[model samples]
Target: MLGGEEGIAVSGSAELRCFSAMASLLLRGIGTLVKSLAGLSCGQAPRCSSSSLPSGISSLQFSSTRCFSERPTVRDHPKRPLSAYIRYFMDQHVILHKQHPDLKRTEITRKIGQEWKALPDFVKEPYIVAANAERQKYKEEVKIYEDHLTPLEKKVQKAERQQKLAKRKSSRKRRELINMGKPKRARNAFNIFMSEHFQDASGMKAKEKFKSLFDDWGILESSRKQTYIQLAEDDKIRYENEMKSWEEQMIEIGREDLIRLKQRNKLKKLRPILKGPKVASKKKKTSVSRLKQSRKTAEPNEGRKARSRISRHEE
Candidate 1:
C-alpha cells in the first residue's frame, strides 16, 4: 500500500508538469503570431523595443505612419513666378499709360497682347532673363517659408484642408438632392418645330427669333398646328416612359424618399382653355337709336297738333 501511494503521487506531479509545458507552448505560439503580424504592418521601419509588443519580439518594428498622413498646405507651397511676356506687358503698360492716359484697362490689355505678339525674339530676350531671376528668387523664398512651419501649424493646416474638401463634397451632394423627383420638362410643340427647322433664324438674335417663331405659330391653320400637336404628344409620352424607368432605377438604388417626393408632386391641375385673340363684335345700337328718334318726332308733331286746323276747316 505504501508503494502504491508513492506511485500515485508521482503520476500527479507528472500531470501537473504536462499542463505547465502545454501552457508555455501556447504562450510562445501566440508571441510568434503577434510578431509576424507586427512585421507585416511595419514594412521597412527600424526595429525598436516597446513594452506593448508580445514576448520574444525585442527586434519588432514601429512605423512612423503619421508622415504619410501629412498633406502639403497650399499657403506654404511654392508660387510660380509671372512669365517673361506678362512682366514685359506690365512694364510697358505703365509707360504706355503715361503717354495715353485715356486708354481703358481692357483696351490697354488688348494692345499689350497685340504688341507682345508682334515683338521680335531679340526684343523679348531681356524680359525673359528678368523673369528667370525672379523665378529662382521665388523658389528660394518658398523653401525657407515651408521650413519655418511648426508641427502644430502643420496639424492646423491639414485640418483646414480636410474641412474644405468635406464641405465641397457635401455641397455637391446637396445640389444632386435638390433636383429630387422633379420631372424633366419635355420640349413643347413650338420648341420641337424650332429644333427641326429655322435653326439659323437668318442671323437674328435668340430673343428676336423666339418672338418671331411664336408669332408665326399663333397664326398657323388648324391642320398645320395638328402636325406639331402630334409631335408634342409623342414627345410627352416618351418623357413619361423615361421618367417611369428612372423611378424604377431609383427603386433599385433604394431611394424611397425620392419616390415619395415624386408621388406627392404627381397631381397636375388642368389649365384654363382660352380662345383665339379675335376681338368680340359690339351689339347693334342702330335699331334702338332709330326707335328713340321716331318717338321724339311723334311727340313733337302729335298729328300736327291732333289735326286741329284741318278738322276745323272741314267742319
Candidate 2:
C-alpha cells in the first residue's frame, strides 16, 4: 500500500507539468492570431515572430498572401475619358443631321453669305406694291387740294377787289350829296306878294288881306275850279321843274351848312377863345330878341296886353 501511494503522487506531478506547458503554448498561439487579424484589418502586412508562431501557421499565412496579391483591382484596365463620351453623344443626338423640304442646302448657304439678299417673291411683295400705290394716291389727292385752293384764292381776291370798288363809289356819291345845297326857288307869285304885304301885319290881319286879294283877283271862284281841273296835268310838270331847282338850292345850302359845321368843329378843337358858354347864351338871347321883334310887329297896341297874357300863359 505504501508503494502504490508514492507512485500515484509521482504521476499526478508529471500530469500537472504537461498541462502547464500546453496552456503556455495555447496562449502564445492565440496572441499571434490576434496580431495577424489586426494587421489584416488595418490593410498592412503583419510581421511574423518565429518565437510566437508555429511553423505550420507561418506556412499557411504565406500561402494565403499569394492568393490575395494575385486578385484583380479597378486601376488595371485602360479607361475611356469623359470628354470623349460627351463628344460622341453630341455627334449622335444634338447636331442637325436631317434636311427640311423647303430650305435647300444651296439657298441656305448663299443666304448665310449675303444676308441682305431679297427673299424669294412671296405674298409680302404684292402687299408692299399696294401700299406704294396708296401712298401715290394720297399724294395725288394733296395735289388736287392745292389746285382747288389756288382757284378759290383767286376768287376770294376778285371778290375783295369788287367790294373795295363798291365802297369807293358809295363814298364818292356820299361826298357829292353832302356838297349839295337847299331849295329856295319854288315860291309862287301869290306867296311872294303875301310875304311882302304881310311884313307888318298880325296873324288875323294877314289872313284878312289874303282873303281880300283872292276876292279882288277872282281867284277864290274861277281859279279854284280851273286849277282843280288842270292840277293833275300842270302840277306834274310844275312840280318836276320846281323840285329840280329846289333840290339844286338845297344841295348848295347843305354844302354851306356842312362847311360851317366843319369850321365850327375845327374852331372848337383848335381855338380856346371860341369854346365858351357865353357864345351859346348869346345865340339863345338873339333868338329871344327875334321873337320879341316879330311879336311887336304882329300885335297892335290894343291886342298887345292879350298877346302878353297869352305868352305868359304859354310860358
Candidate 3:
C-alpha cells in the first residue's frame, strides 16, 4: 500500500508538470502572436526569440518568411507633420474635455472652433511657428526617406496612394448617391438576360453559370434578344428621366456636384447660351441692303432741301 501511494504521488506530480509546460507554451505562443500583430500594425517586421522558436527554426528564417508574406504600407514611412489647426486642436482637446465633461465630442469641437476663431492673432502665433518648424523638419525627413527608397518602391508608393485616393472618392460618392436616392444606371441586354435566367443555368459554380448564360445569350435569336434590348432601352429612359429630376432637385438644394457630367451637359444644351449664332436668310439680307440704299437716297434729298432753303433765304 505504501509503494502504491508513492507511485500515485509521482504520477500526479508528472501530470501537473505536463499541464504547466503546456500552459507555458500556450502563453508563449499568445505573446508571439500579439507581438507579430503589433509589428503588422506598425508596418514593420516582427522579431522572434531564438529560445521560443522550435529546433532548426531560426529568427532570421521567420523574419524572411514574414517580410515576404506582408505587403509594405505607408505606415512604414515617416508620418507627415500636423497642420497649425490640428496642433492647436490636439492641445486644446484635453483642456476642453476636462472643462466640458458633460458636452459631447462634436459639441466640444464646435466650441473649440468658435473659440479658435475668436482668438487673437498673437495667441495663435506660437502654434503657427511650431507648425512651420515641424513642417520644415518633415520636409527634410521626406527628402532623406526618398533618398533611401528605390525607384520601384517610390512607384509602388505613388500607385498605392493614388489607388487609396480613388477608392475613398468612389466610396464617398457612392454614399452620397445612396443618401440622395440617386437612380442606378440601366443595365444592358446581357445583364438583363443574366438577371432573369441566372439561377436556371445548369452549373453548380457562379463562374460556370455565368459562362453558360453568356453562351446562351450569344446563341439567342435576334427576335428574342430584341425583347431584352427593348427592355434595356426602356430602363435607360427611366433612369435618365429619374436622374434628371433628381439632379434638378439636387441643384435646388445647392448640391450641383452630385449631378453627373452627362446630366450637366444636357442642362447646358437646354440653355440658349450654348446654341450656335443664328444666320440671316438671303431674303432678309436683301431687305437690309434695300433699306440701306433707301437711306442713302433720302440723305441726298434732305441735303437738296436744305440747300434750296438757304438759296431762298439769300434771295
The candidate, 1 or 2, that scores higher on TM-score is 1
Each model's TM-score, in the order given?
A: 0.28, 0.15, 0.43
Instruction: Rate residue 38 of model 1 by lDDT.
Output: 61
Full-model lDDT, candidate 3 = 0.86
Show model 1 residue runs off by greater than 4 Å.
1-80, 158-315
The residue pairs found clashing in candidate 3 are none
- The list of candidate 3 runs beyond 4 A from truth reads 1-75, 171-244, 250-257, 260-315
Sorting all predicted structures by TM-score, with the top scorer first, yields 3, 1, 2
Candidate 2 structure, TM-score to reference: 0.15
Steric collisions counted per model: 0, 13, 0
**Candidate 1 local Cα displacement, residue 217, angstroms:** 42
Tens digit of per-residue lDDT, candidate 1, span 1-315: 459889999999999999999999999999997686566532455445667677788566655444333554445556689999889888999999999999999999999999999999999999999899999999899779768877867787778879999999988766775566446658888888777657755447888877777777888788988898898998899888877777767767877455546553552211122443333422236666788999999986987877887899899
Which ten contiguous residues of candidate 1 have the minimum total lDDT? Answer: 267-276
